[model samples]
Target chain A: MKAAKIVFGLLAVTFLMAPLVTILPLAFTSSDLLSYPIRSFSLRWFEELMISDAWRMSIVNSLVIGAGATLLATVLGTLVSLGLRRSFAFSGILKSALLLPMVVPAVILGVGMQITFIQLGLVNTHVGVIIAHTVVALPFVIVSVSGSLAGIDMRVERAAMSLGANPLRVFGHVTLPLMLPGVLSGAVLAFATSLDEVVLTLFVAGPNQRTLARQMFSSIRENISPAIAAAAFVIIVGTVVVAGLVLLFRAAAQRQKPSTVTV
Target chain B: MTASMATSRASGRGSTTGRDGSMAASSARVAAMNGASAPFIALEQVEMMFGTHRVVDQLDLTITRGEFVSLLGPSGSGKTTILMLLAGFLQPTAGSICLGGKRIDHLPPHRRDMGVVFQNYALFPHMSVADNVAFPLRMRRVGREEIEQRVTRALDMVQLQHLRDRRPAMLSGGQQQRIALARALVFEPSVVLMDEPLGALDKQLREQMQLDIRDLHRRLGLTIVFVTHDQGEALTMSDRIAVFNRGRIEQIGSPTEIYDRPASRFVAEFIGETNLMAGKVTTTGPDGSLIRLDSGEDMAASAADWPAAGNEALLSVRPENVTVQPVGTARRTERVNIMQAKVADSVYQGDHLRLHLDCGQRRMIARLDRQVADYAVGTQVDVVFQADNCRVIPT
Candidate 1:
């Protein structure tokens, strides 16, 4: 039974990652435009990617928006989650309302947001784009933070309070530390969402504030070049790198947890 | 969680009233007594309501300086609710709680100056033992060096210092509980509350932890209010045990008193196995009274305040105190209280024999030491108990 499970596990990994495996090698193709079973491989595409001003700007744009969205989503989501917890009067209703951004089709939210932004004259600015991304990011933060909140034995906070610390101190100390990993993880996810956000960005983003996905889309419309493939490859790599960094940070953070982890 | 121990450590403040040596002594006394104060913790006529139904009724209790009190009850008893009230997690709809003479009922739990331990230990799974112990101290803002020193001391007290660097997931249940104990104590809070901290352990481990917890209390002299549904655990470790029922404290006393002289029928039956035989007072005697059983037998019993003549009462008899004799034993003398019985069944448990017998219309069990040998099931026998040993409780 164990051997069978191992076989199935490897098969599943291959099934999910095999497409990326194919795409990665195609990125090195000398002839460009993603032809399978590359006839030749060279470093020209990598060099082309390095020299492309458009690609560099896209990288910078994605990072900035990812960071901004991460910061906004994490803070808003964590606060809302904490408020929602132990305040059930409107939390249930409010939580469902907040989650509508996540479940609603991205195009619909984008359309509504576009109209709202046009009225407010925010359609062509970086800040407008960030707010839209942050809205999508917020639910991830709330869901992550609140998931951990439910795991916390409420008794611990009470225990702290009875010990002498006041309410804010409890939040700053006991409650906050325990829930941070979930919060941090959520922010990373929000950053990932914003970084890859193409559907919403297509409508809400200003031409001057073009994101990586938007840049890639425009480049694809114009023509397929080896640099575009290189850029696409770089994007895929960037996503992986960001995810890896989040994992590393989380592992380090957990190593220093105050609760007993080892036997 | 405390950033420093001082932040979460609620002061009794009574020492401030005294000067010089008296002040030191006052602080020392409170520390010695269990960091308790003049009515530091109060459970005022507290009631817990679930819609219109009251699960816990009005309860009034005051825990003084340095007392090790255990709330003992069976499942569904309101003992846990009272502990929650003291912990500031549950608000009483009708009453308020005062801690250190300040109203704390409306205060959130973080401001209550208490340390709590749950049955599952509630240790953070990602943290090492030392970090877990240091958590509350950290929240209270104790200096880093002091936090380390106290964490070390607390860990050593529980004899888990060697495992301090290990995370909670790696420890055994007993070790986790010990780490929890250290964490609760490292902050030096005024009171520590434990809710069935040892309930998850096996019997042997449970008993061992009971001793360790009691010893820890002695060494630290920290005031604690522990809740457990186990009667043996309560009697084995508590300085005083409060018997709770439905939602009220039925009785409170030392182990001996609670065991030997229970205050009510609920307490007597709840604490241990007892043979409750209905009896009625027939006449008053010098020391107590002459009672007649519902079985139409006259029995003499000594107790304070004889019930009115023919008033119904219950006789609480422990199985260990009940003796059984062969049908022809001459030990059944004239002065002895003997009744004819048949041994309906006998269970042989190492070192003892449990004999179930039927005497007249009442069922009685006698726990006889192994030396007495075994009585075959269905054999006729004579049952006996000393008059003073039977607690005749008025119904």
Candidate 2:
């Protein structure tokens, strides 16, 4: 069994990592084109991307939207999760609605939101784009945090309450800390989703609010450049780092967690 | 919408003659009116409903100051619901509850000054043992020095002071339960409620924890309302037990009173191992009675509340109280309540022998003191119990 497990693990590693190796090295090609096995590597593309207005603006916009989406989704999702968890009212319908964005087609969601944003006079605004990204991102946050909350025994909350902390104090002191890893994992996913968002950005983002994915889309459509490859390299590295941190936090949280903690 | 239980208090009216319960009645009345000697924690007509099915029918219970009370029952008997109501988690559907002479039924759980230890220890995982123990103090904003002193003392009480710096995840199940207990008691609330606190521990560990909890209650003189489905636990830990059944109080009395003289058929069957024989009252006398069993033979079973002649009743005899002997014994004076039977099966249980006897149409169980000295299966024997040991309850 142990030997079989090792073999399975090796197979998974090869399957997951081989594609990354192929895609990543193309970023450093000395040519002004995308190719592997470069004759020489240079920071020329990266420097050129730094000077480009569109590239710079997209990077800044990604940061703004990513941070905004993370904060909004984490707060709203965490609070909603706590509410749904503590009470039986409307839970089934609420959970389904919150999870809908995760399964629905992004194109469909973008179209629906575009119409809504136009009616609300929010289309072509940064706030509109952030809201659209958050609509797609909130589910991930809710699932992550709520999954953690599910694993937590509400008994801990009662224990706090028994010790004389009221509802708000119990949430702030006992609950939020115990489930922090879960909340952070959700926030990471939300930020990462917004950072790579493209379809929603195209439908609703203002000229100033264009995301990295939107900028990359236009570049590839008009003229694919090594600068785009350099941006991709940066994004790939950043994503791996954030995703890795999330996996680590989740693993750490799960390792010490009790199986019967009332999930 | 919230409903609270307002159990009618035993009003301090009407004096009665006492067995040396003389002028004490008048003093007791004055005390009741003055709100003195009232239970530190009292559940008054507490009811809980799950949809329209009343899970906790009107329950009236009182825990005197510094007394230990246990709510004992099988699952779905609403023992845990009663504990939750006391903890302020479930709103009692009918009556008001009083804690130390103050109405606290409407108070939120946190403001009720009661500590609860859950079946699964609800220790905060991110915090160390000291932090978890100090949580109540921190919530109440006690001084840091005082918090330190109290946490250390509480940990010491549980003999876990050395492990105080460790997180709860590092503790064993028994240790975690102890920490839970210590955390609950450290706050020095007027009352502490435990909801099946030892349910998660192994048998040996559970036994030790029971003694530990009992000792703590004694040492601290704290009022406690412990809820458990384990009848043995209730017997071991409680000064008095409230046995629950189908959302109603089956019986409430001291442990031995509940065991030796149960008030109802449910209480008799629930508290211990017993052999029940449904019968009709054939004769009644001043000292004892004889009842005809369902198999049409008269057996001498006795209870104070034995019904009049021809009334259908059930007889409950404890297994250990039944004695087996060779048939046709000639002592003559010790032959009361004798039944001729054959031991159809026997199992040696090290300390006691458990015998299954086939007597006419009824099979009876008898627990004998000797394991090895027992009749072989299918051997003819006389199963006898004293008239006092055979208790009769109304069907």
Q: Best TM-score goes to which candidate?
A: 2
Give each prediction's DockQ, rounded to 2 decimals: 0.31, 0.41
Q: Candidate 1, residue B140: CA error in Å?
A: 4.7
TM-score (chain A only) for the predictions, listed in order: 0.87, 0.89
Q: Which 10 consecutive positions of candidate 2 chain A have the poorest summed lDDT?
A: A254-263
DockQ of 2: 0.41
lDDT per residue (tens digit) for residues B1-395 in model 1: 01111222323333222212122222223333353446657778888987887868888888765567899998778888888877777888888788778888887776677888888887765557777787777667788888777777777778888888887777899999888887877666778899999999999999898887775554445678999999999988876789999888898877888998777789888898888888787766556566788898766565646556778888777899889988867254323467899999898898888999988778998999978957888888888877777776777
Q: What CAPRI-style quality would you assign to candidate 2? A: acceptable
Pick out the ten consecutive residues of candidate 1 chain A with the lowest summed lDDT: A254-263
Model 1, position B140, has a per-residue lDDT of: 71
Query: Interface RMSD for each candidate model?
Result: 5.1, 7.3
Off by over 4 Å in 1: A1-23, A32-40, A50-53, A246-263, B1-43, B96-112, B124-127, B135-149, B186-189, B219-221, B284-286, B328-336
